[model samples]
Target: MTTNNIDILGLAEINVNKNMLRILEHMVQDKFKLYFTTEGKKGTGIRFLVKKEFAVYVQQFQHFEGRIGFIDFYTKKKKIRIIQAYINVQDKEKPQVKRLYKQIEHWTNQCLNSFVKDIIIMGDFNTKWNEYEFLDISHWRHDIFNYFKKHFIKESTLVFCDDISDMYTYIPNNPNHSHNKIDYIWCNIDLMLSAIDSKPRDVQPVIKTDHRMITLDLFMDDIVINKNNTQKCQPSSKTIYCYDEMQKTDGEWNWDKFNKDIIEYLDNPNIKLTTNKIRGINSHKQLNQLWNLFRKAIIHSAKCNIKQKKMKVKQNCHPLYDSDLKRDLNMLKGMLNKIHGTKLDFNDRSIENRQKIIAHITALYRRSDGNKSNTLSDFISITKRHNIIISNHFLHNKTFQYKDILQDTIIILESKYINATYEYKKNIMNTFIQERNQNYKTDKKKMIKSVLEQPHTSLSIDKVYKNDNNKDTFYTEENEVKEQTNLHFQMIVSAINCEKDLSQHPKWQDQYQSKHDVQHTIYSDLMK
Candidate 1:
């Protein structure tokens, strides 16, 4: 719990059945800024705990009506958006379930439209498929994966590294339920490649939740540098100060006051100095000693000039924070929690009436004295008294589609290529088997001739070899060909449609060459 490994943590299924909210708040109080989004029902909610420094850069916090939300914040001076979602394990074919999927897509599409290119789509998706989960699937989940893939995003768990093996992030503690790798962290491919290590920590209970924490470790420099190639506005020069009022004063030169105050303090009867102590000290040491004596005198004189009441007030407590309304408000919230529980129902008429009464009482208490206290009760009372009229504004709000409309040509060509490749491979494999069986009784020379006569069959489907030399020639090495083909496909799709350079992109490289040396190097740094 005291480790320094994580900067941001996303948790799903907070199990609102228990007192997880208050417990979690206490657990991460001093270290993290905990934000929770729930439907205010049992067993539903997603929480994000971000470090305090990182929370300062947060520009937007969008909370949805379901178990999904996103926080767009800055880290390393780069505005990175992190979206966390929790898909319920239910009948996926249901209309409501399909609508949930659409909600995720709509939110993600909105994120992609933002200026921040480095986005992380992560959390408990509740899917079983692991390998190429985002690409090969053709169900309701397919839409989510396809959108990421088409936009050149890649799964962090799939990136090849010796330390990261295929393992499940979710394992029910109850022995009857089997483990599954449902939780995931999908980062922009470029951002993942720079990772020193990226994988799930372990399938363990965190705050009694049923999912493990996924970790991504990268160099600090990699996160801070802006590689998006976009112009950014300069940060504003503003200072926030919280200091004692005695330390602040507006005045012109007051040398006479300074000298008189200083001389009076230094000339007091209590002042004493040893002759031997001064005799033993050198010029440089003497100057420091004299300055310290004079500084103490100035401080003591300034303190004495302030009245007793003002000094006592400054010494005892903050002038702004002490109030009777605040005390009543705190007491009221504690009483409500004890009586009704942590989950308050704002929609219930009985509960709403009680809340209104409490607000009125607190407002009366604040108004009794001339003290200005912006208590929660004051706001509630004001809200009840004044309602903003939105008569015609609702008519203009239309249902505009947020789904990405991909180019027709790109979709047609991509579909054709996939189908063609599948068919070609199936036909070639069938022909190869038939020819080998048919030529069982043939001689070695004839068999060789028959196999060679078989129309062009090669494992490198995209590569073409020329018959220039007498010696047998083959396509490039297995790894090289695969890399080339992967790169080519990424380039074609990302270039023409997505406006992304796939070959040079970090995410693309991690996807195809997951087992490459660069990935190994990334994990090596993490291990160190």
Candidate 2:
């Protein structure tokens, strides 16, 4: 990376287990600072190597084990966040792989809630390069890419810059051997201005490596506002955890048919048992030891037999507001309005006015920022009280005006309003999130009901046969194999598109009953 003058490098599929991954993380270097999959991980490993100069600006580091992660850097009044991912090689149709895509989507959701404007995601996505077109609906519209279609990712758009290329990252030793361009670099609208180009590095000796390095060059000065002249917002750190191994117990557990399922989970050799210090379980030393052993057995079996979900707990900072945050956000919004109304021609174009608007936004971001309960989600989203999807990009081109100052500002702030009818897009987005969570909490089984009621036929075969890290699945042909995915869905996830256990799928219900006929529901007797 240093030889290539690369300041930041992302390495995916490091091909090491958790123990080895931990060892590599400890083996530090002088020149480059590393961010590894410390928590919330799966698969192999993904890491980031940042030159010391840039590494000093790193505000936070996070990742999803062997799959994806990101590093946040604050420099020159701009936040340059790099999200690195290793999309594993697997059948896309499985529910487990879909979990990976959903996890990516979840990570992107975090990006939107951020106060920082420039976000870049780069890594080996494992997209079927030759099988798809850059602009084809099948490619971006597919559940794989999800929301990336709206923003410039691998392809260039009139609004954003991307170095279009047909170069492949996977090269074979023999020239006749097949290869593919599976790696990609994506930037948000703000970073698009600084994106010089993204392309594959020169093909190296195929015997030395199968995958070539990909790089993106950015004109940092172009995107950054002078930090000396700008007021900085106190950055919020979003905590990361590895919950992918935890089971999702939303759907009812079928005790009658769970005998063989529980046995399979318990018998699996890969089940890792760790002894952590416990409290309040039992006072006696012997009983405490016995209780811990029993608890471990139960949890290990549940994780293997039931569905598991890998997720990053979202940071909610609204509670940090001391009645002052709300007032400050309103004041910031009004100040932004005054700038446009006072001067029609020069207001939006003037760098001073733009800087003031940025300051106001940052002020709101830092309001009551007593370093408590804050997170990386864009503060704009939660500062408001209402459900709306976050809106379009702001400041795409020269002079950074979207159609004009008023329209551009509205695009960023007015997602909640239908036809400019009401409020900030952030508020609207937060409203939706809150509503979804409330609904899920009110009815844990609602997701199961919704999943069962939905028209399964309407969904494509790929959608119906989903992938998840559960052993009870029966929809696919590869049932006998031991498969694991570094992803799990929550209650809202199940409501959206959660797969049912083989015993619960509507079509197989009748046939599986006979499979269920001989089995009986076993209950633990508390009275005894």
Candidate 3:
């Protein structure tokens, strides 16, 4: 029976910080059979109030936060489905307001699913009709009006109040703004006809709220007449018109169940997870941790590469240059050859070799510096020679190209390595914890004794080397020692391999080589 489109904004302002509670109070005071709010955050704040009579058979209620200020309420009304809501203004070109308008359109489009019956959309639409019988507005407003037209939501004022003298349902409180008809109540034509007899009188209520409250009444005359005539009709032959109001239907759709099903499908190790499944939890802590580690590795590798380059520069600028620098020159040339057009081959071995060579050269230069008799020219000559080698290598292979290829390849390799390492580390950590837990359970007494035992310095050799004639204890001790050693070795090997793999990764070549003129040109154009 409730048909008035209430201005929740006015209610919100009155309650201010206590908006939710205040709205609840208002619904109670007005004896609202059903209620909804657009101000709710993510639909959590939305509340639905039902009269006691109606609440009994009301199986479930559902609401969705739609575009703009819109919230769609779905309810089982006497077993018949109904959708109710207000729409926000759609003005998509005005810099500050386009986003809100687009959101409304999105919601409207989503609501086009056919299951909802008796769709009644009513609210304060801060807009005017496109083809007005009297006034003209901007083209953008007309465009918005056309959008509604396309959606088949006819202008409510034009359809319902065309014959009325005072067609306007809204009054501008501000003197500067124009007075226009902006409020409306709209429904499908068939539903509108069915409720014609119950229409409310046109005397708008001037409550504490700013906007005038209008209402539509739904008459139950047919229902009353049928009930009265039921005395003469046989119970078996009688048709039940109000039975829908007494029956309960299915509950509202559970989106959480759907989400849970999706997550299970993806996280199930037995089942193969797809790309679509992974996209669901983008900001999950586990995935974020992996990504963070990968990012850090990339940054560390880049820093190492940069440091090597800087060192090479310094070496080139050294004053004491070798007259027969051909040996050093050949080494540099050979390194460049291995790297040329091979961006993806720099694994642990290559990285270790590069680092070792850089360290050796740096140490030599440092030793030379420590010698008091060494002059600035000695350092400058050495540095200049190295620089020449590097410069030549850069020019010959087209420095930009190789550098780009190397950078890209390194990034890709690092990301893959990080992902693999994360899983490996997780597994190892879990195993270690499990083993410790098992030891605590099986050998609690011995573990305690070991902790309380005298220090190795204080213990006599005889006590330390006591022969455990008991086979079980000796076997247990041996197995424990072997297990501990194996675990330690595994940890050491994993750590070493991880470091070696990362250092030797040839990903930088891909990044380095791809930065050449040809690639750069293409990249620049794409960016533009």
- Highest TM-score model number: 2
Evaluation by lDDT, superior candidate among 2 and 3:
2
Looking at candidate 1, the ten consecutive residues that score lowest on lDDT are 398-407
TM-score of each: 0.40, 0.41, 0.32
lDDT (CA) per prediction? 0.58, 0.55, 0.41
How much does each candidate deviate from the true structure in C-alpha RMSD?
Answer: 28.8, 30.7, 39.0
lDDT of 2 by residue, 256-373 (tens): 3335554555455444233543333356885667556557766655554444445555555543222343444334344444444544343456777666544433343343655432
- Worst 10-residue lDDT window, candidate 2: 479-488
- lDDT for position 341 in model 2: 52
The residue ranges of model 2 lying beyond 4 angstroms of the native Cα positions read: 17-28, 38-43, 134-141, 152-165, 173-177, 203-207, 223-528
Scored against the true structure, residue 45 in model 2 reaches a CA lDDT of: 75
Which candidate tops lDDT? 1
lDDT of 1: 0.58
Candidate 3 root-mean-square deviation in Å: 39.0
lDDT of 3 by residue, 284-315 (tens): 79577655654554454333322221111122
